[model samples]
Target: MKLCILCAKQRAVLKRPKTGQQICQACFYHVFETEIHHTIVDAKLFRRGERVAIGASGGKDSTVLAHVMKQLNEQYDYGLDLFLLSVDEGITGYRDDSLETVKRNQQQYELPLKIVSYGDLYGWTMDDIVREVGLKNNCTYCGVFRRQALDRGAVMLGVDHIVTGHNADDIAETVLMNIFRGDIARLGRCTEIVTQGESSIRRSKPFKYTYEKEIVMYAYFKKLDYFSTECIYSPNAYRGYARTFLKDLESVRPSAIVDIIHSGEAFEIKSTVKMPSQKTCERCGYMSSNDTCKACVLLEGLNRGLPQLGIGKESRVRKQIAESEQKELPTVVQHFSQIQRDADAPDIIQPRDPSTVYTPPPRMPTGVLDPPTKKTLDW
Candidate 1:
């Protein structure tokens, strides 16, 4: 067998996809971890004493990410208080099974784990949403809700930054998806290593440049336990087409993944383009591109028997709303800021009693009622 390319010692084991170098297991591990460390350092992804939450999905990428984040935090003296944060979308047999893996990882890595569920946060689970919306457009509710759920979970954890396991291939697929959709705004920013949410919670991808193959190899050789299952609801997602296309290109040229990311990074939007401005959601106080956040709009649709309210053109949704008889819209259970405050002092209030009756207060003249102090029917 040929010797390792880097050490010229042990026999070569596997060839890396990014560099096409044959190396031993030890060398592979060293380079894999080193490259990620460099990415973090070069991007200045963390502060010395910041509390960081790893967005653990119990999948291969996330399981590997939690292990590596803990390893690097200790080995390089990153001084980061790392925690595992997971969003429970309440998908039966899928998310439920995967969370068990995350729980085991929490124990193995000895990091604090916080799980926020859709049922608890938004009063609607994935199963329920799917049942209501059917197979079509169910992903829209999930994507919007999960994004906000993670942010809210991070806030409750009081974390300074949230890091996900989005790898090079994932980033490349996203670039292709944005280009195909002609989403100029998302296309311009999708390649960024780090992004700040409207709430100022920083999110980064430490594995932004890491290959998915390498991550799989590392997990396999290390004998790490991780869940490997496609989300049952995402079989028809548009991103799947983009992913398949990118993989085809990668089969022809291994460098296609990194090249796509670099291309996205280099592509600049013209100043004349009109980008959506960020605003605070009037309902929940979350940052949104519209007056109401997508989550709120979707929930409204679900509650009002208008599941397509946020699925298509805003003008059509408005027309539908105007055509229907006016009814009292649901009020948010709690404000985002109030939730943060409650998180800071866990004993300040008692949990809402499920037995209590919910009466929708009279609608304000402004039409946007303030968040109810008591829980709503959904809650």
Candidate 2:
């Protein structure tokens, strides 16, 4: 029996994209699936013995990705040792609720699922971090920390490559965000299907060209178990703007998104905007362009009373910290953190009064600092 792509109903709409080759929705889905499978093979995203960890969020995109990848790998005999890697962000109702779906996914697919969480490594879950940092900064910390957590998990799993459920819409949204911010290098790198050579594990996005709507529909037709809750603290204004803009465009023109991404790959840049070289984080030894990665920097902010770690916008971090010693007063009393810090306000260095026993700051043995000589300040 033939299938319908437009509605997934038994009856067909007999329509394809206004542009491009004429194919039914079912046929289009097959095309999407075949193209994605071929893309993975052509890109050489997996090797015979190497472990591949699918970044499962228990959401639609991930659910569909895991399903499709599992099917293709076996059918094509890709020789991939597929494992599921889910990073629990620990949002009370959001992540806590969603994680159940991941657990169920393990049973449904009969794939070995490894769940790693922020609470385990950072001693702070999204819930705890949100309580201290508030909703405004929750997603920022979660996203940054989640990236690191995934890498760390892959390390523990001894996997060499990590595949995320990042679909075309997400990729399109990110591209627009980077372009709007004038981040040429990130814009160039963000579209990369496979990231290799730097981090502990290589990361790739097999669904990089798939659409979110199609993924959701695929999950629905397949009747796959998935968690359908937005993160409780997903309050990123910048990314929200990009998402809204993309959705608006998607409504007006269906192929607008895929076309945009293809153009992103196709567009040639004559300018010399080289991507900054990545170095290991001085604190955590993770791959980063700066001396310390964003994750390490945010971790420092949380330990200190710095507001900037929670808030990534330099303007807002500066505004909040201008009142007092914000995020940048050293996290060390007697030792130095490995972070190559941004310029700190100079006023905080005066030694406290001897009578007032100020507790030493969080200590990191970075080994490059002049020792703090305690010349007691007058009370």
The sequence of per-residue lDDT tens digits that candidate 2 reaches over residues 1-379 is: 3345444554332233223332344665677688789889888888887788889887887888888888998888888888888888777656655666777677677777777778777767778777787766566787788887777767656678999989888888888888888887677778889887334478999988776655654565456777666665765656888999988887678788887787677656556756678677766667777776676667767777663653555555445546556435442211122322224211211222434432222222121112223222111
Task: Give stretches of model 1 more than 4 Å off.
Answer: 326-328, 341-379
Off by over 4 Å in 2: 1-29, 197-200, 267-275, 310-379
Q: Write the per-residue lDDT of candidate 1 for residues 102-217, one digit (tens) a residue.
A: 77778788787888899998888999989888887888889898889888988888888999999999999999989898889789889999998746899999999998877877
Clashes of each: 0, 3
**How far out, in Å, is residue 80 in model 2?**
0.5
Compute each candidate's TM-score over C-alphas: 0.89, 0.76
Global Cα RMSD, each model: 14.0, 18.2
